[model samples]
Target: METDFQTVEQAKSNIQALLKGIVGTRTVAIRDALDQVLAADVLSPIHVPAHDNSAMDGYAFNGAAINPAGMTQLALVGTAYAGRKYEGTVKSGECIRIMTGAVMPEGCDTVVVQENVTVQGDQIHFAPGAVKAGDNRRLKGEDLTQGKPALRAGRILRPADLGLLASLGIPEIQVMRKLRVAFFSTGDELRSLGQVLDEGCVYDSNRYTLYGMLTRLRFVDLIDMGVVHDSPESLEAAMNNAADQADVIITSGGVSVGEADFTKDVMQKLGSVNFWKIAMRPGRPMAFGHITNPNTGNAAFLFGLPGNPVAVMVTFYAFVRDALFKLAGANPTAVPLVKAQLASNVRKRPGRTEFQRVRLERQGSTTVAHLTGAQGSGILRSMSESDGIMVLAHDLGDLQAGSEVEVLPFEGLI
Candidate 1:
């Protein structure tokens, strides 16, 4: 393990270089494939809209029949509704009353909206240049061409993707199998809910926080290993057990340097683990690499995060979240950032990257970021009250009030 701290970008790149998406895949119905990664590209079996159709409730006629400088009149011979077509062909002097989505009559290519025509008995009259040739006509294969790629491999299925598949008449699709992740919190001073707290112990909030975040990722299969006591034997047993069952293992609290930090020792002994002191605030001590169960020959990726509640969340968002998405065979998208003016001056150094909790306030016409008091790693309430995290980049110095900054909103990510 290198004692020198790694930059945030270096740590992310190193982690990604070592990972490959899971290999296993299965076919499932479209309804059940939500948030699942596609194992294969989906091709459209047929053209969408399959035929040339009318896009509005109007009168369909050939454009050449209309007189350019004067009112044009055509006899209305028949009507066409959606899902039904007019049987007869339309001549140059004839038109068909067509509803939205109705198939255009044979020999007719343009549609003048109903509002643009005046009806007199069986005759409909419209002014010249009402609509050009092919106006308001939906052409065959307009939305999707037949035998074309509709969805590509490695794409995560969303609600809109499901609708697209249904439109292509695809009932089921091939997707990567769910990734199993085992997680637990470490520290002898931590206690679970409903347990009696000792004089020196506090209730374990890391596991609950981890649970909420993990649950939001529908593609992940969670294995909550609960809290493991701070002991060499206990840590070893849990690590080996988790490796045998999960593809990835996450632990909070034991990666930091302390007397009871036996997690680092056990991880290094079992696998090729790299302990990294990242150049970032809220989360600095982290461990990344693979751990194996020697007896079963089963190996799993591991993320050893810091002990503080806020640090766990920040590290997970900054590092582990995308790592999990990539390992599960999905092409993850980066979360977007919005610019906001700072509400007050911020005291920041020039080396390490910082993520400060800030409440976004809309004052007058501008949105400003207000600091949520002291930004300590143990302060969880600040995170709860904030709208998003203001990311202060590495090498950025102190900023005066009203200076613009980038913010990562908590709308999609908690």
Candidate 2:
């Protein structure tokens, strides 16, 4: 009997449960940390700014008590700008007109609003004592204290995070290296790009689509192993080499029960094959396994995706890539997903969940998605033309027009 699987969630959970965090590590510059998960906690090395500074383009006073007579005048001392500090101490009854980001001068407690004073040549009048020391002033390490936890482990690095790290003078950071993924397509019916098509031969869309999708997601590096013939030894040799070279292996087709399908047999012999038939259309025959590196005792995980172009693309986004990232020591969860409105009319038969490729149109505060005219798994047009996929529930047999459904946007991920 074969492994009994029924739902996409079940299959995904089963597959993810088998992955352990990869221990490999590498150092990446702060400029290159975007999208990479931090391996260690980032602590603030010093107080941010390292000194006191002004927040507004106002004046700095000796934090003096305001004296409101008919007119009280404080002498205009000097100007302070960012990166340049005023070294002179403010005298009593005197204020310094400052600019934004200017450093606070010694003996200055509060910044009186420039608008509140009347300037007469080098002298200005304060309305009264109305402020305190360090008002609107940014003290050293105010934004981040010394040794505060600025970033924690397992957090994916983003633009803002990188900026903060740079402000802290961190030039380089330690991150889990990107998981090396080896990709191949298995089918005699497929032909490579830039090659003329022969009778009964179709262009190998899966290999390229998978490659593009992986590239868009910012994978560390992808090895294009290309396509392999259906010979058992040829398939085995390809798998063995990839397992030795890459941390994760992904192949489309050859996992199904057909005369030419030898992927499962080789995967099992090379490692451990955990079989399952997911309860979803277009991606029902996905498989997962791990081939132990005989020399190093480390196992290279393999994800067997469907041969259909749309199926391969959707399943890779939903499944294999997450596991690959996990093997590279990235945060296994929190992958991006989007929701769109159902624009076109599409209906599905009961008993299986359907991932329909749909073109999303933004029309007046709503996103409408239309199913690609052709829905055939082998038809690569829908996958190429559509923006993303609209998911139909497993038990939903028919979805009518104008019915609201959830759609995951392609975003930057192809």
Candidate 3:
């Protein structure tokens, strides 16, 4: 295992290079495929707006009958409603009243809105320059053409995607199988909830936080393995058990350079693992590799995170979230960062990226980030009280008040 320090970007790139989406796909109805990854490209089977129809409630007439500079008049033959078509051909000096989405009558390619025409018994009068040729007619295949790709493979189906599929008359689609993820926390000083609070032992908060984070990703089947004691035998048994059932395994703590942290030894013995000291604050010590179950030959991707509460969340968002999406056959998108001005000056070192918790407030038209209390890796409440985590880049130092910064909001991320 390599213990050299790596930049955050380098770490991310390395992790991405070593992983691929899990295999296997199954057909599912569109109704049950929300947030699921598409296994194949969805092609349009038929043209949208199958027939030429009216775009507005108006009179449909041939474009040749339109008077460019003077008043044009035509006899109103009949009225057409949506989902119905005027059967008879529209001859010269004749038109038909058509509602929105109604199929245009034969030889009628334009529509003069009802508000733009005057009714005089059976004759409809159009004012000068009222409408142009094909002004309000919807052509067939205008929205989507048949035999064309509607949604590509590796797309995460959303509500809008479902509607688009329904519009194409698709009842079912193929989607990648749900990714299985098993996670747990490791530390002798950590205690489960409802247990006696002994001296020098604190309640484990990382598992709960990990649960919340993993649950947000609807495509993942979460397996919470609870807390494991920091022993080589315990760590190996847990890793073997998790790898047999899950595609990915996550552990917080026991990967750091401490005597009590036996995770590094256990992981290296089981498989080829890399221990990394990433160049980022709140989360620095991390391990990435695959743990194999020797008996079953089943291996799972592993993420060994730091022990701190805030560090677990930060590292998971920065690294694990996208990796999970990728392994689940999804085209993962990075969380967007918005520009905001700082409320006060902050001190920082020059080579490490820092994620500082801050509350956002609107100052006139500008958004300002107010620093939260004591930005520490162990302070979990710092994340709770803040609206976002301002990312101070690696090269920045001693930012002055009112300086601009990039912030990842907690609204969608947390």
Q: lDDT for every model?
A: 0.91, 0.77, 0.89
- Expressed as tens digits, the lDDT of each residue in 334-407 for candidate 3 is 77897899899999887888889999999999999999989999999999898888999888889998999999
Better of 1 and 3 by lDDT: 1
- Give me the runs in candidate 1 sitting further than 4 Å from their true place: 1-3, 259-261
Point out the higher-scoring one by TM-score: 1 or 2. Answer: 1
lDDT of 2: 0.77
Worst 10 residues of 1 by lDDT: 255-264
| Global local distance difference test of model 1 | 0.91
Which candidate should be chosen as best, given lDDT against the real structure?
A: 1
Candidate 2 residues lying further than 4 Å off, grouped into runs, are 1-3, 62-75, 91-93, 106-118, 122-135, 194-196, 259-261, 293-298, 332-336, 349-351, 395-397, 412-414
Q: Which residue pairs overlap in candidate 1's backbone?
A: none
Give TM per candidate.
0.96, 0.86, 0.96
RMSD of 1: 1.9
Question: What is the number of backbone collisions in each predicted candidate, taken in the order shown?
Answer: 0, 6, 0
